[model samples]
Target: MKKNQVVLFPVLLALFVFTSCNAQKNIPVFSKVVYEGNDDIYNENPLKADEFYNPILQGTYPDPAIARKGNDYYLVASSFAMVPGVPIFHSNDLVNWVQIGHVLDRKTQLKVHDTGISASIYAPDIRYNPYNDTFYMIVTQFAGGFGNMVVKTKDPREGWSDPIKLDFQGIDPAIFFDDDGKAYVVHNDAPNKGEELYQGHRVIKIWEYDLEKDQVVPGTDKIIVNGGVDLSKKPIWIEAPHIYKKDGLYYLMCAEGGTGGWHSEVIFVSDNPMGPYEPAPSNPILTQRHFPGNRENKVDWVGHADLVVGPDDKYYGVFLGIRPNDKDRVNTGRETFILPVDWSGKFPVFENGLVPMEPTLKLPEGVEYKAGEGEFFPNGNFTYSEDFNSEKLDYRWIGLRGPREDFIEITKKGLKINPFEVNIKEVKPTSTLFHRQQHKDFSFTTTLEYKPKSEKELAGITAVQSEKFNYVFGVTRKDKKHFIVLERTEKGSSKILASKEIDFKEKIQLKVEAEGDDYKFSYALNGGDFENLGGTVSGDILSTNVA
Candidate 1:
């Protein structure tokens, strides 16, 4: 059933269809895609003048990391098993951002072609070092049999170098280039051999990094923070370590607790880059665990942050957070968010972060909030469309586990997809091109021209969270006629909700809309009025918890 579905677009367009269909050719063409974001929160509050919404890079973009090079700022997020791993963005002011590209775009760079959706690439850190004038992106890639890899380039726009594998046993690795021209790498490692006191008991280890060799020095490895801030309390899952320098002191910041409700960002300071660091008096600097869950537009799971100096000469932090629907299910995935930091005291604190978060920050004095300019991604309520007219596609549309080039082709007519035999239920990468669920209340409409030659062929739209959790709605053959079927897959078990027997000659319009927990799927034949297919289904299966 993976053959006919080709091309995915964030914006609603005349779905994937061409005037002519070659029976011998296996290509399924999608002309255009257009999507408009219309969440209730945005419509109520609205973007007034200089204000923008929280979760700047919306939809499942988690584990945010930031790096600054003079006036230009760069931000990145963990892509997990998505091909073109590690989505990157650029901005002059933190308010307006445009996606630059991805760090791992080539097939050789991403080896998750056969791995599970949640098994590859965790907690990526992007840093621009002034010493060698290079940008470094380091992370732990679990699939493809690689661990703790780092890649560098003089600039991010041109692309990145092949991985320079770090010889370490850990996850969430970050590199710090000191003012004295020295480099050090810090990461989360398991309690040594027999030292495992408890589950989730982990250690943050540091090693002197060789800039020229692009590897860690074997002899200088040392543990900086073992078992988190207060060993007596016994913190669990302390990871995502970042080192920052202010004046003469060095700060080691990491995400503490598990990535669930108790998740938080903690800080430690020391005189040396690698030393006996002391936890800050004000630990758990940024978190939402203390607030009530029923608050308006509540944001939870606040942790995994990276800091940078803003263009306004103030400190700012970018991290991951989630927006749970009325049912308290995380369907759209973890999103990247930004907040101003107060570093005037001994250590930095996320401003207004302790309170219920309303992340409409005032843009830096002179900068104005502009939406939909060039590649500058628009937040708040706005519309975006793609026609697949270009030779290269936007970075926002990504493939799962495998590179997009392997399955897609750009032609004058439209975008075509060569489906793999693999379905979305399996761990292997499918032919689906995903535009992560951006807004909870939104409409996705596509007019596609596809003919199911057999019951084995199905082509349409799907709302997916992972291989095991998703809603599959597409057109296939049943008996002698073509029928549209809707199936919901949860925890690897699928149930067919409804199937419609329809007669159509050329094209059909399909749509899936959601309002919080309720999701509806419908289709229109030959440009007729859209008719409902599967009444409404719960969107919880399409969302996930951070843990």
Candidate 2:
């Protein structure tokens, strides 16, 4: 397979769930798999039995949380403010994943109104407790206020129950079920002043949870691990906590040093689930902070991990990491990556024996996975075209805050976008639907056919870093004359970067290309050659750190 190849895969878009196999049934089972090679056609052949990709999931599927029930594995990620929040995926072999549905598909399930793009949902933990035959998802709503909530259901693909607001004070809530059937909610507790005074001084707390009462038992709350693995160093942001018991020893894992450059995963062990946990001798069980950025090795910010044991009795860690495009620009945001863990030692470590992360790995023995038969390039790079023929839209397409389905209409021509009263320049949700730029060197082309009634109404393709930072290439009407305009917004200020008058009947095509650390916007008429409309915009401006 060549390095520079773009494969386009066309699949069905739905409001519920789309499965790769057994579509007729509510719980679909895999029959055949698709292999994502560097080609336009799907490799109908099954995997070579020993090879697999690193990022089982691509694009902005970050902060992955996984739970297993028998042979079926269910996965969920932090959807932030995107509608149909917390997408759930089902996998048989843990390699090929298909989007079943979202946990919060209904508007009533979550309140993302006026929430910033990056300030809504944080790290969410999904756990299946067989004791009650229920799947519980505990997460934080970080929009207008800090809210910790939980939602559960027996079936994840169908839908989830309404949010049960909890009294937890902090974020990144996780649930652990002991062998004796006692359930506990462990999470990063906020710092109380007058005690430890450091930048990231925090503690991990646990409380006895009553499923029937749908609340935590009062007076059962206490700090289990204080100030991370070693309190002396005052490790920063000890968040995303999960507890597991193996060999009668309770192992508590949490992310430390924050989520950026110094992000890491550490572990502590205790005889009891509630008290006096000791740090592992080899702390920071997994990290990429020690390594310098290298184009050849693109994975970085590797932390926020969750451990799951497969049917093979082997342990695997699914965590979040970012892949830089060029010059350390992270346009794809955080992505989900999985690595086999070696538990031979007192603690677990990545078994890859490489720095940062490996792009490929050998699958566990006797595991077979089927690709999407027609799915393309599943190894991180994503390319898809949306004709919007169906009544619903693709799950990959995201809107700001809350999505307004009324703005989207299926027309005989194509998907029609009735411009919302607000533009993308505002902090509120808009009529635009966006897909993440999964690859650094890729192009996104969209056709817009609209007759603007007023200058306030303009439809086009936008590359957004946040509500304050974005770039738009749109067409607007002035005195019955159509014009192609390019605008860039920085720090709440909008500027018309460039503009050109175009002879428009009713439609035009807009294209956005990413080359290295810059983006180029171009427009064309009736499927003609694309002409550059504005100067290049630095991709770093839309990076996760800056945005």
Candidate 3:
């Protein structure tokens, strides 16, 4: 017999024997294991899939602000334009978290169509007022000129009150209620107040506010800190100011150096909450420590950090970082990461001063993975594909704004996205392939096969966070020619980075990889090798919306 025939005979014989055995037992058999991951992290301890399939929270976009009430710990993250802004996750131990609910649910709180992902609620700081026994959520809505919006609820899950606008200028408003029962709001100056022009820098200011009255002291705003040091010299866009009083010293922590590569710190201290604050002698509390060659070594875009004390009384800091894709550019969106913080005299001391944490660190203790405990995935991660035949959209997918039910549908073949009234420029209530920010550097490829009858019909892959900034890789019909294009739209301009004529093929497979600050695009014909389209694109295209 031929070599192929000989090999097939044994395989067929083994399959026949296995089928007979299974039939006799009257049982169905599956070769793949259902559970995964090691016991060290999860309770049952299962084999973990490849890293791409299994994403543990890491890097920047974490924007975690945790509040501990008794044994229960509540965590909130910046949702930007994603519907259900401020994802609220609950955890007994800091390591394993389950999504409990979202803070903003009412239609009055968020408009999914007009507000893009980056325009929704910016950085939100969650805190519990012990005296009144109430949960307060303070978020900066950038769509309304970086104004602070306040929402309070006795029960975070259901009884949230209407959003009350706090008259404050600045993005990333943090609320702090002092021991004396007085509440203060600390934030940066508004962008249009000429701060972005004079020094190209905004001042970090503190103002007393009455949550009950829903009003600030009007002109009571006082500048607590300003850009001055080497990292802050060139009109640094200081934002996300968090204040904590510990050991008779008031510590002011804020992010500086813009929100991109080479971004560093600007921490200051003041004995009193209002008076002039002094910058730390060793500022820039943290940076991309993994890169050691230059003082400004670039890796992850780390900022928007929150500090919380564990039940064990140890302090931990959670912030966002971007992990670049294979090309060393980050496009997967920012991710959250945790680091240890120690007090040196009066200032916070980070190991190696301002370096990024090593990939491997001691996992937090007292964490037990509770499978099937969350509102979405009670059993941990599940398999998901762009294929639309599934009954409902996976929880992993999030619309920049709330989407209408008619926007998308599934058939046995694949997902069918109905054209909406909006386009890429205008915030569309329904858009194809909308998802939350996952990792910084990851490859997202999809097979889109659509025959547009007219020039209005378009389909493709997009890395979109907001209406103003996004990158689209797809085929557009112009005149009678079908053009494969990679276009990036930012501010108000849509520029085609690369384009080519499309060949009528079975399907179009579009792949985008973001390294550090660069993006690579390629298209393949059926299962053939990917052909590069053109010149390299800067990673900055994504930086605008993400930060």
Provide TM-scores for the models: 0.94, 0.89, 0.71
- Give me candidate 2's TM-score against the actual structure: 0.89
Q: Which model is ahead, 1 or 2, in terms of lDDT? A: 1
What ranges in model 1 sit over 4 Å off?
A: 1-26, 545-547
Q: How well is each residue in 119-171 modelled by candidate 3, as lDDT tens digits?
A: 56667888888878888888877563435788888877674777888876666
Clashes per candidate (backbone, < 3 Å): 11, 6, 30
lDDT of 2 by residue, 1-547 (tens): 1011111111111111111222121211111111111211113322455877667776678789999988889888987777768878887767778777778776677677687666677778999999999999999877645488899999887688888888878778999989999889999876565776676688899999997888888889998877887777778888889999899999999988876777888999989988678899988889888776664656777788998897678898899887776677677677888888889888888765237566767777777545444432245343465666767665666556666474556655666554445666556666666666666566777666655554545657777777677777777667877788888778878899898878866556777777667778888786688899877877765766455
Q: What is the lDDT of residue 368 in candidate 3?
A: 47
| lDDT of predicted model 3 | 0.59
lDDT of 1: 0.81
By TM-score, the best candidate is: 1
Best-matching candidate per lDDT:
1
